[model samples]
Structures are given as C-alpha cells and as structure tokens.
Target: MTLTRPETAATPPETDAAPPPRPEYPRPDRDRSERWVNLNGRWDFEADGHEGPITVPFAWESEASGVHRTWLERGVYRRTVTAPADWAGSRVVLSFGAVHHRAVVRVDGALVGEHVGGYESFEFDVTEALTPGVSAELEVSVTAPADKRAIPHGKQRSIPRDDYDGVSFTPTSGIWQTVWLEARGRTYARSVALRGDSLTGIDIAVDLAGDAPEGAEVTATVLGTGETAALTADGSGHATGRIELAEPLLWSPERPHLYRVEVRTGDDRVVAATGLRHFETRGEELHLNGERIYLRGVLDQGYWPDTGLTAPDAASLLRELELARGLGYNLVRKHLKFEEPLWLHEADRTGMLVWAEPAAPSRFSPEAAAAFEAQLPAMVERDGNHPSIVIWGLYNEEWGLDWDIPGSAARAEAAVHAYERLRELDDTRPIVENSGWSHVRTDLVDWHYYEPKLAVWKDFVARLAAGERDDFPVRLAPDFVVDKSLYGSAEVPRSGIPIVNSEYGEGFTSLERAWHLRWETQELRRHDRYAGYVYTEFADVEHEAAGLLDTWRRPKDWGGARPADVNADTVLVLDLVPLAAGADIEPPTGPLALDVHVSHHGRDSVSGAVHAAWLPAGTPVGVPVPKPEVSSGPVTAEPFRLSSAATITVPPPSGPARLLLWLADESGRVLARSFLDAAEVEPPNRRGARPGEFEDAPAPGHAWQPIAFDDS
Candidate 1:
C-alpha cells in the first residue's frame, strides 16, 4: 500500500542528546549487551489531522501516552536517531516490540518493511537505509480499524454502547509496545528455542541470520554451573544440540529454580533463562514434574487503569505477578491478549504457571480464521522457551466462531483446525482448543459456569465431579437451546480427561463476591475428580466488578475474610450448604450438624482438627472473626472423605449470625476457614406484616413484646 506524507508530519524534537536509559530490556529471553538502544522516551505523533508529542511505548488511547483520546483510524510517529559511534561496520536493525493491527516502517521516507500482526515482534535490516554515525529519520505508520470482526481484538470494544458490553473494554490503537534498534553481526542468531526437560535435559536450537556459513561453531554454556553444549551449523544455517546436567534441579511452584544460559556463535551472543520441568496430564490429573498438582489459577487480563495494555512501568509487571502469588495462586490464565514478554518473563522468574492465548476475532470467516491462525506460530515461538507456560489456550468461549460451535459444522471444523495448528507449532504444552466450552479437541475437559444460587451450584459441582453429567447448560445464540453440551459427540469422549472449572464466579457486592470465592473454591477442592479452577479475574477492569481487587489493585472489603484463607493448599471443605446471598430463612431451632472434610494438596498427608465457632452478625467488620468454640480431636485427613466433625447447639439469635469453621494442624496454625451467614428472619406471626408496618411497631394484630435470645 502506497501512502502520501500527511501535511501534519510530526517534526523532530530540538535536541541532539541521547535518550534517557530505557526500561528493562524489552526481550529478557534474548539479551544482547551494549549493542542496542532503546527508543522509548518520546516521539512526535500525528493522527487524524492533529499533531503532538506522544510517548513511545504507550497506546494512544491510554493516559500514559499523553494523547489520551478515543479510537483513531490511523497514527504516524516520527523520530530521528544516530547510530552509536562505536558501532562502525555492523548491520543496524530497527526492531518494534509490537504495533497494533498493522505497521509500516520507513527510514527517511524510504519504506523499510511492514508487519501485520500486532502481538509479534518484528524487525528490519536498516543498514542499507543509513550510514554509520549519521542521523536517520525513522517513521512508522499504523492503521487500527475499529471493526473487530476483521481482526483479532480481544475484549476491546469496537463501538461501545450505553448498555452492558459484556467483557469488552477500551480499545487500544497505534504503537502499544516498545520500539528499539540493535546492532548484529554479519551472522547472528535469528531465533533461539530452548526446551528444558527434567528427564532429558535442555534441548537447544538456533536459527542463524544474515550471511551464515556452514560448519559455524555454536556453543551454549549454562551460567554458574559451567556446563556447556556444542553444536555445528549445517548448510541450512540451523544448529541443534542438548545440554545434560549431572543433577537436575526440577522447577516447580513450590521450589522455582531457573538456569541461566548464554549461547554464542562468532560475535553473536544471547542470554536466556529456563527451568527444567515437565507438565502433563496423567488420567484426570495434572502432573508437574511427575507429581500431581492442583492448579490454583486467577484470570489476569493484563490491563491497567492508566496504561491500557502497556504496563505503566517495568515494576508494575513484576508487582502484579507478585500480588497474585501472594494470594496463594500458582497459575495465572492470561486471558485473551498475547501479554507482553516482560510479563511472561516475570512469570518465569517468580514461578507462576501461565495459560497464554492470543486475541480472538469477533466473527468467523476465512479471513478472520486466517488472521487468528497467523498469531499461533509466532505466539508459540516467542513464548515456548518459558517453562512457566504449561498450557496453550485458543478461542475463549467460542468467540470468533459465531458463538455457535455445537450446531455449525464449519465452525466446529475451524475450532478443530485452530487446535491442530497450535499443536503443530508446539507439542510440548497442553492445548485447550476452546477454553471455556465447545471442546471439539483438547487435552483437558474444562468448562465455565456461573451461578449465584448456592444450592444449585453445589448440586452441579457434585454431579459433574461424580461423572453423572458431562455438560453444563450454555446458550450461544438467541434461538439456540441452553441445554446443549459443549463436548463433542461420540467422536470425543470425556472419560479420563482432567475436568476443570476454568471460569466461574458471580456476585455484585464485595461481601457477596467473597462469599462466592470461598464457596466456589471449596467446592472445587472437595472433588478429587476435578483438577483445577481459575477464578473469573484477578482485578476489576472498567465495567467488570467480579474481581478480587478493585480497578486500583486494592483488595475489596471481604467482610473480615481474606482470599488467602480459602486459597490455601490445604482447605477444609464443609458439607453445610448455606443459603444464597440476601436470602433469609427461619433459623434452626435445634443443634446444627455439618459434615467436614479435608482437601489437602500438599506433599504429605495432614492430620488436623476441625473447629467450629459462631460470631455475632453485628461484630465489627474489620475485627478478626474466627475464634473456635468446639474442636473435633485430631483426625487423619483423607481426600473426599466426609465425617460429622462438628455438632453445636445454640439458642437462635435475635438477629443474623455467622457460623465460622476452620481447620488447624497440631501446631494450631489455621490452614483454611469458611463461614456461613444466617440471615435474620421475622417471627412466624410477623411474616404476614406489610413491609412498612413493621418499621416502627409490630403488626397491627400482634403485641409489641420483646423475645429473649442469646447474643453469644
């Protein structure tokens, strides 16, 4: 596509000095020294006849970009830079971490190259476009159409309406990732793929670039350990070898150990970090390094209030991972967006497992399918080296499939094709064909279910775990039936596959939301057939309020309850089903019996005592609430084994109350806690009173007599 220079071309700033030190290197997996420059400070920006200065890495719609506005059809950025004086003969390359939709690069008005995918990194050899130590004008033109059906725009609303827009959020336009320049040797490593296996060691593959000759010597040295592996390049410029460790330190969420390696060939050297670990499914269970693991995951949208998709700073990326880990989550499902490499790097460093997927197109078409498929190879190639990523997800909730995969054969085929395409790209990780539902093919049988009624949710969880039902009710289109199963027919049986509640949670209030979090997590843990679960979200985004934290990343008031309490590795699962939120019923007149079970995922069996207590409903909100009143003597915990651990008789309270239950080890350390709210109910005769009649006095026919009740 040819383009004429706009009259509002952004002019260069009046400065000859070098830019400030850039944020941490954009690509942590492949690091090169002193030979690169970060172009992230400022650039003259123009779009839709308006000209101004915009930040380099932030999207135009974000507050951090200084050009915070609505969506734009097109945007142009211009800057001038001079190659470092020290680099005399090496080839200079202009690299863009990523650009939205489509981007065209130019040096001094001469077109250098172009890239279409927005999430993949690309570069151009700019040596021919400039001379050493000379100033060169760099220009990038970007076009981001608002039609999401034609492109992969995950959760980015195209035309926001006044009503609910589901999970859609603000749209991001123009350059949203880092831009930089690097110098490479005549024969440098183009790409490096490292596959570290605890059983087989680390497999290394290097693809050479530029004028690479045959028989080039390639060496990979594991830093600190002094272990090295060597390989020779063939006529095709590809070298492959394996590095075996004498005693491998396997990587796990409990003990995350990483191995830093530096690979060299001639003058080209890149440093990468990987851990020796293996993730697989062994008959209805997820195994990490040969040990079964229960995935405690939270859905992370990778967005910020002010920065949009681009994190405000490097520290923000690490902070989010740390926050999730602190909440007792070992895995984060990076929903939709192909998150920045820096975020993935943090996951690797902090020992958090990641389920990564690319953005999905809103509609199904040949062009849309191709656009979606185009991102898979690059996604796997760019992120396959990270051992933290255990699963590759595609097309969440049947998006881009017209939201009708069960009835349409063509859409089903498309979903299957996408699954096969991703598997072909990288077979090392488990691939979820359609993450939420309509699983034509997948390594795990996962579903997304949301129900606020405690009784219904409880029954469904029990039936699904006991293998009584394989599908949940889901409605894709207006006329479609809601009873259809997302699972494929006889072709794909659900037996022997790990079942997971990938997405499930619903509540409008913070207290209600926390109630759901505690109950839902408890239900999942109570079933041994279930492998894992991912809460709806980590933090609240624009319109979605079902998050553990608010938009500002502050923990919501969970009414004296902490998420870590229910998210612990060992949890006490109670059989008492509480009433739904805001629903009141007559309080029990006799002793309340509850069956308690321990769900422990630790390395060894745990022996703990089940404790029960009651707290006045009017207790101060922020005070510590759990104080045990009755303890069931030490009992050996067994998975899914229910026993009547507690029975307490108390006088019905005059007002609402809370029943608190907890599991404590021999040392008295509280491992998990759960609470049941007993809402206040009116007297038998007062139930017939009009809503307003009881405000100031008793019903018209009843006397205003006070009944005595225990407060404790």
Candidate 2:
C-alpha cells in the first residue's frame, strides 16, 4: 500500500520544554530486555488540516499530549527507527500498550497490521519488512468516532450529559498508553494462568504463540521454594503442570506474601508473582482464603486532570495505593475503567484486593453487543493472572442493556452469555452479572442506597431481607429491573445471593459522612447475611465534591475524627455534633447545650478517661482551651453498653469555635474522638427529617413500593 499524508506538514509541538521521561514498560507479564526500544517521544500527528508534534501514549484530549482538542475524527502518527543488527535471527515485534478505538499500521510503505479495541494490547511481527542496520519509516492511522454507543467508552463523552458527565471529566482518544518494540524468538510463551492451591502449591497453564519443535516441553520453577514442574506440549501448543511447596504463606491484607514463578518454553521465559489465596462466597458471607472477612473498600476511577486516563508517573500510582492502605482500606473497586497492568502489579505487591470491570458503551445495539462480547472475555484472559483481582464485574447499572423494551429476552440473554463466558474463561473468582440493579444469574446481590437518613437506610436493608424491596432512586434507570429478575418474573425465585451495598455516599458533609458511615457499617456488621460494603469514592472527580479527599488529593478532615476512629475495627462510636458538618445550630448564638451519644462495639469491658473541651478554630497549636470540662468520669466499662444523653455545656465564644471529645486509654493514647463545628459550614446534605423521625417500621408485607417506570 502507498503511504498517504495530509497536504500540510506537521510542526513542532506547542511547547519545547522537555516532557517527563516516558513511563517505564507498562506490561508486567511481558519479559524485559536491553534490546527493546521505547517509541514514546514526539511523533508527527495530523488531523482536520492541522498538523503538529504530539506526545505518544498520552491521549489527544489531554494537556500532557501538547494537543488538547477532541474533534472525534481520524488522526495519524509517524516516526522512524533503525533496526538493531543483533536482532537478525529473532522476530522484530512492534507492540502497543493500548490505542483508543482502532488503528492501522504501515511500515516502510507496506501495510503491516490493523487492531481494534481501545483497552487491549496488540503486537505485530515486523521483521520481514525491516532492513538490517537501516532506518525504517513507520505510520499509524487511528479513528475514535464521537458516537459513544458503538465502542467501549468509559465515563467519557463528546457532549457532556447530566450528573456523572458534566460532573465527571472529558473523554480521551488516540494512544493512551505506552508503545515500544522488542525482539523475541520465533516461539514464545504467549500467556500463562497461575492459580494457587493451598494443599498442593501452584497450578500453571501456558499458551504458546508460534510453532514449537516436536517433544518440546514447558517448565515452571518456584524461585525461592525450589519446587519445579515440567509438562510436554500437546498438539495445540498448550501445557499444564503443578508445583508443590513444603510450606505455604497465604496472602492477606495484613501480610502480603507473594511467590515468584518463572515459566520457560523453548528458548523463551517469563517471570511473574502469585500468592496462595482464593476468594469465594459461603452461606451469607464472603471468604478470603477460607476465612470470613469484611471488605473495607473505596471506589477508584483512575483518571487524572492533566493526563486523562494515564497516571503522571510510576510513583503517582504508588501514592494512591499507599494512601488507600494507610487509610485502612484493604480493597478498591476499580470503577468502570480497566486499568493498565502496571497498576494491577502494584496492587499485587501492596496486597490490595481489586474488583475489576469492563468499560461499557453508552448505548445498546448489535454493534454494542459485538463490541462488548469480544472485549469482555479478552479482558478476563488478559487480567486473569493478577492475584489482586477477586471479582469480575460484567456490567454496571444496565448502561448498554435495553431493559426498558418489553419482552426483550435478547438483552437478558446477552448478559447471561457474558457471565457464562467469563466463568468458562476463569472459574477461580465469583462473577457479578450486573453491579447495581437488574442482577441476573450473578453470585452476589449488589445494590446501591444513598438515602441521607441513617434510620431510612436501616429500614431499607430490613425491608430487602423481608422479601420487600425499597426504591433505589439514585443512579437507577427509570425502567430498571421491571421484568428482568425474580422480583418481577415468576420463573426465577429471589436468587437469595449474598447482599452488598456496592455504591453509596455521593454527597455528604464531613460529620454526616462520619455518622452515616458509622451507622451503615455497624448495621452491616450486625447482619451476617450482608457480605460487605464499598463507599462511592476515594477522591473527588471534577464537579463531584463528595470524596474523602478533594480533586488534588488533599484530605477533607472528618469533623475531628481520625482514620483509626472510623476504621472497621476499634469498636468505638460517638455522636456529639449539634448538627451535620455544614449545618447551622438553631439558637445561632448563646451558651449551647449539646447532648451526645457514645457506645463501644467491642465484646470485652474496658476503662478509659473521657476528655471534652470547647476551643476556637484558630487557637495556637499547643495552646489549651480557656476552660475544659470532663464529660464522663474515668471508670470501668462493660461490653456492648450504650451511654446516651451525655451533656456538655459550652459558653458561647467570641469567634467561630468547636467542641472536641476524646476517649483515651491508660497509656494516654486516644482510642476515640469526635468534633463539632460551632459555626455553620458549607454545602450540607441535611435535606429533610433526621433519623428516627418516622419512628415505626413498615408492617411485615408492606415493603416500601419500589420506584418504577410507570411511577415517578
């Protein structure tokens, strides 16, 4: 094929200052070599009669790419590289970490290959077209259409919509990850699946790419354990084996122990890590390595302001993982986006569990069906080896499924087919057919509840357990789940799957978030049938200001409560805030009388000193309050006991002030703390009545009518 170019010649990028060094090779499973070359520098780009140098691997819609325009049209990339003389006998492989939508490649005026799917990796063997020790021209034509329904587009949009769109960020196109080239033998290990067996050891499955000689065998060696297994390849070029270890150190959030395994086939070898662990659901609870555990998780969207879908650097990924771990979160629900392998590798090393999902197209059609069906299985196969990923989320909130159409068994069938395909691909982890609603043939009954009132939330869960469902209006489609599940169809009974509040808490104040989280978390803990919970998000995105941290990753203080005070364990609770974090006290000015509630969630008795004080907001670091009082005298306490109506009288101060309460142990270490702002803050969700306003629970069969399409 002849090389085609636009009439205008491309110019230098907008800025001459050096961009940060390109991120290191992002594919964790692929083997590394000194013979590889990084093609991530400036590349000539052209689109819509405009031409300029654009940064490779950074999408055109981002500032880091030196071109922040999203025209939703075709763009071209061109570069030149000289082939290495030492790579004469090996195959010259050109690999793309990921290219958005579709791409056509040409090398030295000859068409080499074409790849579709924006979120997957692809490679081409270009050795036959390369001249030894000579430079070869390379070009790539990419197309990312504005029609969001046809492709697997995550939370991005050509035109902003309501709620998650304008509040969310912009969409990205073109190359959004690293691009590189390397030389490999004719026959290589294409992929490997590693599963841990507690009693035996590790199970190894290998898939090969090129031709292998007769009698060729694949071997797996455990690095530190000195265990090895070898198996001969069958006619299909696949092999399986098992390695036994003398002692096993199972992986958990508390202690993340990973065992490295090296797989060799023919002249090729690849190294990766895995921990001996399995995640499954039993009766009403989720178990990790055969022990029941609650998932204290935060939602991560994996988007950045400057780089679009890419992180600024390797350390940027590490910082987010470290921050989540420091805040006592053991798992992160990677919302919507299928993250790069580098991020998943870090999660494995840091011992963080992940709930991975495929990015959904905006609308449903035959094209959407084909696109999703093709990509979902590939996503599972590509990410199956990572030990951190425990759950495969098939769909989310019915984005692409046409549930509104009457008697649309096709929509339901498509969802079930995807779930079955995933199970066939990897049977190690549980599958969530649909995340929020319209769950069909799923292993878990996951839903969302965002009512601001704690008492209402308690009632909702109780109603669900009693076979009476309540309205989940937030983020639900008008015609959602009408006849999709057993709740509507008589053919299927209430699947009785384990329940989890997958998403909640989008807009709440510091104090409200603290109190609401405490109540909701304790409620789940009190009920064994509910598996666990995942809060809406970890940090704020664009206009959504409901994160524990702002967009720039700065922590928004939780009234005065620290991380340990709100974590799952500790077992201490207090409620002294006169109103929600940003609400005004009714009196507006005077000596205020505050009645707080306190309770211990532990099972053993304890003794501690309760300290209370009222101080101005801007008091000096070490300066003490003018006059402090003891709310509760030091005394022995019994387990599961409640102390209600504890009052603390505070004289009105000259300026804005706060009341601080702390319960300290014998060593003077604070076990629990709560703070109340004297003045009204900003943007509180104190919408209607507070908790307990509707004092009585609904009668046995009187399930709150679920909001439906026919109703408001």
RMSD of 1: 8.6
The model with the greatest lDDT is 1
Candidate 2 segments whose C-alpha is farther than 4 A from its true place: 1-20, 159-168, 197-199, 213-215, 403-407, 453-455, 465-470, 475-496, 508-528, 561-564, 571-578, 582-712
What does candidate 1's lDDT look like per residue over 1-712, in tens digits?
Answer: 0011222112222244844323568888677756888888788999996799888787888876778877687999999988886677777888887788799999999999999987777888888896778898999999888766658888777763211135678888888888888887777787888888645588988888776647788999999888999989999889999999988888877777878888888887788888888999988888989888889899988777766777766765678888898777889999888887888887887789998989888778889889999998788778888999999999887778876788888888888999999988887888888877778888988888776556667777888888777666543322233553548545666678888888877666877777778787888887788889998779888777777887667778776566776777777777667555532334556566666777878777778787777677634322253666777767666543333344433445455677677777788777667666677543447767778564323111000111111224
What's the count of clashing pairs in each model shown?
Answer: 0, 0
Clashing pairs in 1: none
Model 1 misplaced regions, further than 4 Å: 1-22, 159-165, 198-200, 475-481, 582-590, 616-627, 639-656, 681-712
